[model samples]
Target: MALEGLRQRLTDLPQGRFGVAVSGGSDSMALLHVAAETLAPARLCAVTVDHRLRPEAADEAQMVARFAEGLGVSHDVLSWADGPFARETSGNLSERAREARYRLMADWARERGVVGVLLGHTADDVAETFVMRLGRRAGLKGLAAMAPVTHFHGVPFHRPALDERRAALRGHLSGAGLHWIEDPSNRDPRYDRTRARDALRHLSAAGLDPDDIAAAATHLRAAEIGLQHLLSDWATRHARTHRGANLIDAPALFDLPSDPALRVLGGALRHVTGVAHPPRAADLSRLLAALRSGDTRATLHGCLVTRDRTGIAVLREPAMAEASVPVPLGATWDDRWIVIGPGESGMSVKAVGAAGLSQLGNWREAGLPRAQAMSGPGVWRGETLIAAPELLPDGPFASKFARDDFPAWLASH
Candidate 1:
């Protein structure tokens, strides 16, 4: 029954090469086995991310590779040891690792032209996530937890096992005479997820089942979707984009229900700043309160929001401006703009600082604030400013800014 369900999900996905993220665990191994049987070997590839945080991570990746090889499926191991993962100094190691894992997998998928990457998140994982979010006093979106399909850095991330149970997947593996590795961290009480899992087991014994929790999450997800549709319409009517900044009708937004209003401002701030996560909820609430009193200026999530005669303008925080960095053809800058090089060998992309703004002969004629214009994408060749595409007329080098899809972005993060 589980295999049939898995086969149906795989068949429903878009017809193209698919990438499976395998960690040599029971759930992931079951997914890989089923995928190998359901799809042609040529249509599937697997990637194992070795975070290198533990000594056995390398061997576990090799084990997954051997299993994939036996199934006639090509596989690759992406090491995080050499990337920013190695140099991370953040206090939240788990969050950092999660971010790094997705980043590496997304890059691998892009290079191989895969349509989507599949994960092995299961029903138990969803329940634990809900409990964790509940403990944190999260909003509806956070409690809703994981989705079956999401996009990260333009690559589709699919979790086909969300409806399946961990034990069921392990049972399938056992029945097939396959063995899987167990990460020690899964039982470590030091981690919040581990504690949540432990608590969920006790709660299940006390009559509150994990399945019931998962069902509640499903309902919350539906409510979240309904709110997103309403917010989309609100944004269309009251939000305007100018020179990479966002101008939202302040009075109109303030008139909205607190939740939707907060979401609108948060979405605008995220879009203007090009950050994956929205600003902290508490900070946003405080900002909204301040805006209600009178004209206000505040900063959050790398963006500056100011209420003025025109409206509320959300701009990239000048202090957080991206430094000049070399950008090859088809490369993205600041996660918001894509640099289109004019077949040039030496080109770099950066925020149009005061110096670059001065080079724009008739800057004021463009009708953008100097700070806002300075935050626009600028292409440079050595010491010469090539173009500030957002401020200037179409020219040689073009920077294409990605449109903000708030609902999709929020879900993925």
Candidate 2:
């Protein structure tokens, strides 16, 4: 493969400062070199995230920094610590590290006023991910290839080489007299990705190469986009939001094929709970079956699902709101609600518990489920209920959904 096309694509990007995430790997280092070739060094900023997972990680970051300096490109090394997984010795360390890395990178990009960050995901990644997800029996969305452009943690990310291969990038580096770090974890069988990489060889020998699988994943991505359109249409016709709860027309939802129905229900779960992804396939399937079988209510993913005259209602579980924190007057709380009112120093936001609910005699008249209302954001001053905006229309404070409306939320995620 030639670098001419990649150079053209890089040149076509909008004129502004763009960030590049380099991990001292061959793919990323090649990307950095190509980007510096296409754009001004001042327009290209390199960022390296030292996950501190391995001993050599720090030195690797410094190596990338020095390499960037040689290209006249400024580089910064961000360290990751104090995340939720920082102290945990087990449980999906890869996923936790990935999430933390993106969060740190997003913040860094925003702070530096970078327009977007460029990534180095190649075709091999798409194929390896597909193989890993195949083992989990993933559906279209899970099996689809990563988009060339996507958003994470509200930051834009661009992958200009999803169509390229790892070997080609390494070859490009070798020809340029450049070198890259080879993280030991690449061969660690303890990780799923390493196993996926091993599986790729056997798969290639069986007449299916990475490019072939990547092309198939591209097809699946197209199918997933079409389904998203269908999902948005269904949401407009059958969904409504009340106070933070999503009320979906049960008859319309139940009439949908299992796939679309599951998407609708899953999107609603994420919308209500503000979680990034839906519940696991097994758990979501069981919950869907229970609902169709006339189970009145169920709980999963910090959300409560119940039947009502309107249809199925998905709202934040009261238990999930038990750990309330001091409200930042204009900022969001619990990732769901925003309270606008006087910024009294000691005021906190908590769920309207039974005692607080008793104070709001008109809560029942507000036409919300007891549990949903109980979990509504209530402004308080040391047990002194100041305002329950969802219940009382006239108050010093007002509460509203911090996120988009149900349909838009469903479509975007």
Candidate 3:
């Protein structure tokens, strides 16, 4: 079927307003065009986020607005005023951009009261994602790829074309008398996804098709779902969640079927606490062992999870207030007489270089720079570089710390 297939998908969606994220590229533009036509988006809006990374990015956003305007759809072009970087060269630029783009669209949807946000991930993309996750030692859950409809940050993400093939979308665009821009980055070797795309094309040419791959993913997803159902029952029988703790019977987890044991408990832990993906295999095993062992505590995701006689308690790391409470020679204390500088009335501070800072403990992984106190009360925000004591204040970015007798704790969240 054609993206003519999309007409049925659009018909089933609620009649309420929706926003499409259009980047002026073929995939997204095709979605914007078809969705606007079917949804009669005279009330719908197109949000174009200009990352300003490309020289033509602003122009591309403008083009998307023009396209929406021609369709009588509302349009807005949002640009970054100040962000991580105008052009970040770090390791995961595309991933970071994807995160930023979704966050921007969700915020826009909330403001405009849009019911959902349409995305343009097609069938081929889903197949590629399945294969890529397989390469990364993924289980069935990861191989299932993106869901067709997922709610995030108060907005629903709709990939109405998850069921539509890529060539079909192009054909539909041609049939609708519309053409869209192609991004050259897709062929760039600098990105790993391009290599994966080429590999998938190679595999497909050798006789694999989208339906075959999608079917495999569907099977995997089903198996995982059944396993999850079983594990949910197991957890209910043996696990307990309390105000500040969760008591999962470690022995019971060991007794459950292995796959369900890992996937279910891992997912439960993530949901109960604000955690990212599951820990690595070794970390997870060690953490489980610590729970049964005599260890006092083990930290995970900035909090401590400890095993007690009855259950496990997860708590925030207590402040290290007693450590170096008095001012040392070269540390800071809430921006007051932190270093060996001429003190100003309202708390003066000075700066020290890399040499002045030393390893206070094995907390470098804590994300805060470690420094020794040489002079006043040493202060920091959750191991972050807040202010040294008025007696000793020396560290990089130390000069910027300000002190107000208004009480620094008052201004804190």
Q: Write the per-residue lDDT of candidate 3 for residues 1-413, one digit (tens) a residue.
A: 45667767877887788888888877888888888777777647888888767778888788888888998998998775534473555545675576567656776887788899888888788788787777788877788757677654336888888777878778777887887777778789776667777878788799987668877886776776665566656656776543223456666655666566555445544433323346566666666667656534666533455665545544322232132233333443222233443333333232222322342333233333222122213333333333442223344322322222111111110
- Return the TM-score for candidate 3, rounded to 2 decimals: 0.68
| Model 1, CA-based lDDT | 0.81
Q: State the weakest 10-residue window (summed lDDT) of model 3.
A: 404-413
Question: Which candidate order results from sorting by TM-score in descending order?
Answer: 1, 2, 3
Candidate 1 is scored at a TM of: 0.91
lDDT of 2 by residue, 1-413 (tens): 46776787798888899999999999999999989988999999999998877778899999999999999999999988844346467656777678778878877897798999999999999999999999999989999988888766556799998888999888899998999999899999987899999999998999989999999999999888888877887799899888999989888989999988998999898887666678888898888888887746899988999975657999998888766555556655666887898768778777887768988777888887888888888888887888888888687899988667788766656
Worst 10 residues of 1 by lDDT: 404-413
| Residue 53, candidate 2: C-alpha displacement in angstroms | 2.7
Q: How many angstroms is residue 284 displaced in model 3 relative to the true structure, after the best TM-score fit?
A: 3.6
lDDT (Cα) of model 3? 0.59
Task: Answer with 1 or 2, whichever has the higher TM-score.
Answer: 1
Residue pairs that clash (backbone atoms under 3 angstroms), model 1: none
Query: Between prediction 1 and prediction 2, which has the larger lDDT?
Result: 2
- Each candidate's lDDT (Cα)? 0.81, 0.85, 0.59
Q: Model 1, 410: alpha-carbon shift in Å?
A: 7.7
The C-alpha TM-scores of every prediction are 0.91, 0.83, 0.68
